[model samples]
Target: METTQNTFEQFKLNRQLLNAIEEAGYTTPTPIQEQAIPLALAGQDILGIAQTGTGKTAAYALPLLMRIKYAQGQHARALIMAPTRELAMQISEAIIQLSKYTDIRTVVLFGGVGPKSQIEAIRDGVDIIVATPGRFMDLYFREEVTVKHLNVMILDEADKMMDMGFMPQIRKLLEIIPVKRQNMLFSATFSEKVERLSHEFLEFPTRIEVTPQATTAEMVSQTLYELPNFHTKMNLLSHLLRDEEVFNRVLIFTRSREVAGLVHQYLLGRVVREDALRVIHANKGQNTRTNAMEAFREGSVRVMVATDVVSRGIDITEVSHVINFDVPLMYEDYVHRIGRTGRANHVGQAITFMTFADEYHIRKIEKMIRMEIPRTKLPAEIEMMETPRNEMQDMLREIDNQKRKEDPTFLGAFHEKKAYRPPSKFNQKDSRARRGASSRTKKR
Candidate 1:
């Protein structure tokens, strides 16, 4: 394929911004940026839906910076709303990198730390504000910042914001901002709720989806290992990380910060170097989180463990492998987790640890993704894990019991909390309940 990159001068962007883009080593525009930038520059309301790691930040940021540079006033004209504190900071960093030579000022607002510094930054009169919903609302309500002069608004990762339950905050923000302004909603996927929210914010929007819905990147090679349970997963992971190539730049995604720390400690015991592994999650303070992310990006940390909250906005390109320490709650999350790697035509691997309980979820993921993920056998040392097997089966039974509990007509087959619920007794309500009643009457 021919390279479509031209001198930044061709875009008619401010000379300073162009210099910064060149300095940042962004020679070519990714597909999303190439398609969306022109429309956004023309002052169009854009709804851009593409998988993560497609360079969507520049797709909107470059044009917004250009527009802001060309226009008159300089009072917080642009606002970018991200879902998490980490993401908000990441977007702010991108803006700074892209606007290095320009005189544009930016501020990031998030709740984990104190608000004094953020308030001072806003008071200093910035041209752009990148913020999470909670802290932004707090400052907005306090009248520390005003959107009355806002020119452009961008919602990066709109679906994630919705998934994190920020709809009410987003709606309030929309109502607060002036009616006549440019708006853009960029996300990995557009669910029904995202569409509904967009209708309230955007006027005559141009919708664009770069990738198919519910599909993962084609460049990612996915594999699943049916571990007996958590401990055996740890054993397998220890073995895999021992391979120097795989240990370098590995990212492990867990469900929560507590889990991330636990995994990090467990891995630390087996790994030779203490500095090889780092953990980042929401519970950590801002400085700790920033240091961890920086270490991961600069190649100082070999294996970085994180929760989903920190995963979306992380833009590291050379991540070697993504390990799913815990299966995600939603099938779409599997796609997102693996998306951390194999970005922008670079081949990468995604290894998932599945227990018996996770088997059904894995199957559902396959059905949704429409392809069978290759299964990998555990190493011999980890194979003799009968204890984890029992735990795995017990976990599966627990999940099955929960599903059966949800069935409306499921009658009590046993008494007390000690009762055992078998899969055979768990059946659909209409026919089976009547059959059971008739059988009981015959016995009577």
Candidate 2:
């Protein structure tokens, strides 16, 4: 099937959208955009399955903006629900840019900040709302936001929303919103949960899949390094970042906030300049995360250490490398993480550092991607560090848990061992005395 739109003009988008597209330097439509824009413009529900960084935003945003050509009402006509605040903001920005020539007004609603401004924005006027489910519901319950006019609903990163356990809120939203609405659902990978969601959310949707599910981007060259411990991984990361020219504009993804912080601290003033390094995770204030992301996008930050919070949210075009400091347990995220670098058809590199505990997840990720990650030998200059005893035990326990998950009866090496033993003399004497007392009482 041909999924390429040679030019934006071919879609017959309004002159305003075309101008914005030209200003945004979008010469040709991406695969998802090519397939979804026409269907969306035709007022059909859309189920878009494409890897991240494939211009999925524009695939839906352009048609959405066209549908809402001008802001006429006080209430929003379109609602776009993203999984994270960062994504909500990104989507809002994209829409704002696309709708610049029009009178469309977009407001982003998210937690971690006061709702006063969001409420004020909605009260003043908004044609489109880009929000997370919780924040949208909060404002809706408070009667601050009205959804009676919502005729278009979009669920961006639907898989991530499901993973974040936003189903109940989404279901509630569905019940409250007008049933007569156009729906569009986009995801990097369509898992079973997301599939179920599609059945509930979409009505006779036109499914558009630009790539295979969970497949990494073709422009990204993936490499894996099997290390012995966290310390070694850190050392290897430092060594790789030392090459300033090649590793410029890198995004380092860790599985947890603690690991992200550790990696940020490890590289500060050593391998990366203090001013050129930034770290972002859930614990960071919303403003702090926004600033870090902006810096990384603007080329002021050489390296950014972050958790998966921004994996599917961030949309930067010049990222040179994406380093997986820890293999993602949610295997689908591997595609999103690597998709960050190889964007806009630019060549990018995805390097992963896997410890023993992470090997199982790496294998699963490989299976999902349907390709084995080529292993690279660690540089000899970097000395291997010894794994801490506690760290080693944790890895072993994790491995055991993985094994037990696979085999119910498999006892781990750490499982306690109980052997048969005779009772001690003290215990034996106490037992005899207790038996004699009981016999005397019975005779009496």
Candidate 3:
């Protein structure tokens, strides 16, 4: 018996897509692609469960492009919804690349910038509309987008959309679009919310899971550093980035925009060059974020610091290390953040900095991923900075809050004093005054 080779050509894609795939340097299909493309091509709705950086975009985009074939009418025939503007743009770029040899035009809609240009793109001619839910609905209400011609609808990062509360808009969209269209839903992790969304979005869909849900990439090595405070994490980050060979192309993730900015500022001109470090968050301008992302992708930026805004869909294959400057409270996002590295079967490192308060979240993340991250001791040469008094108090308060959340009856340290108090001299005097007032009232 002879076995056939697994290749994109085996899918019977058109010559144009085959050419584009070859030019794009794709040798073979990824697991998700191998499993999903055929079902999608057969006009079956797909529920794809795959982690980030697993060629999920291609798995869906290729089939969508093949179905669209060529641009025909002035309206879009397909709609792709993403949770964030960054992810919307990323998917649009991938679709454009895959459909280069064809005449299928795609227009990306997002809210950070004005809709003037996007409206113009739609007016000119578009076969596909890739957009965030809010922006898509905005354009739809304005009569700029018509769903009558839509034959396909896809929800990329459905779990993220559920997290960001896009369900109402999604439900509204479902009502407006043609009910006869094929549907596809892709999620990095399958949660209860995602499962419910899948039931609502897809009709008797064929489910494909390339990997066990929420599992990290096998090529990435994960390590944890239990530091005392944020300052010590900064110290460890600085020390790690000093070694250029190993830390060459790095992505640092923080939980908030403020932390992302601080990480960028700390590394500027100290560990990374001023021009080689870029930061992005929800607060950054659209142009600034796009330029920073482009620069990082083009290899001009050595280190990019970002919040979870860019975690789910932005695909950068050469990331050498992903430094979790702060543990993510949303445990699923931990999988997406580490996935920024170890892309395309490349060996990568994921280093997490966990403070005392972060330990609770880290445990939750480990439980979700079904493995404990290896802990490493700080190098002897790097001095562990003493945590400031205020920061220590904040961490303690956070820990107390976490504990209280887990056990509602368990009062926090600050609440313990209020819960039980011995009778004081002031309390005794107040009690005597109350008793005298009660006796006076009784005499009256």
Query: Could you tell me the lDDT of residue 343 within candidate 3?
Result: 88
Question: Each model's TM-score, in the order given?
Answer: 0.87, 0.92, 0.91
Of the candidates numbered 1 and 3, which has the greater TM-score value?
3
- RMSD (Å) per prediction: 9.3, 13.0, 11.7
Minimum summed lDDT over a 10-residue window in model 2 is located at 419-428
lDDT-based ranking: 2, 3, 1
Q: How big is the positional error of residue 414 in model 3, measured in Å on the Cα after superposition?
A: 1.3
Q: Give the distance in Å from residue 20's predicted Cα in candidate 1 to where it truly belongs.
A: 1.8
Write one digit per residue (lDDT tens) for candidate 3, span 1-444.
765579898899999999999998998899899999999999999999999888999999999999989989899999999999988999998889889999999999999899999999999999999999999999999999999999999999999999999999999999999999999999988899999889888999998998999999899999998776687688789999999888989999998999898889888998899999999999999999999999998999999999999888888889999999999888999899989889877999999988767878988898889999999977755545555677767876887889889998877877656442222411224434655676698899
In TM-score terms, candidate 3 sits at: 0.91
**Could you give candidate 1's per-residue lDDT for residues 147-219 as a string of tens digits?**
8999799999888888889999998888889888999998787778888988887899998888777688788
- List, residue by residue over 1-444, the lDDT tens digit for candidate 2: 865449998899999999999998889888888899999999999999987788899999999998998988799999999999999999999999998899999999999988888898888999999999999999999999989899999999999999999999999999999999999999988899999999999999999998989888889999988777788788788889999999999999998998888888989998899999999999999999999999989999999999999999689999999999889889888898998988877999999987767877988998999999999876755546655778877887897899999998998866666431222411224434655676798899
Candidate 2: stretches off by over 4 Å: 1-5, 416-444
Candidate with better lDDT, 1 vs 3: 3
Model 1 TM-score on a 0 to 1 scale: 0.87
Among residues 3 or more apart in sequence or in different chains, the pairs in candidate 2 whose N, CA or C atoms overlap within 3 Å are: none
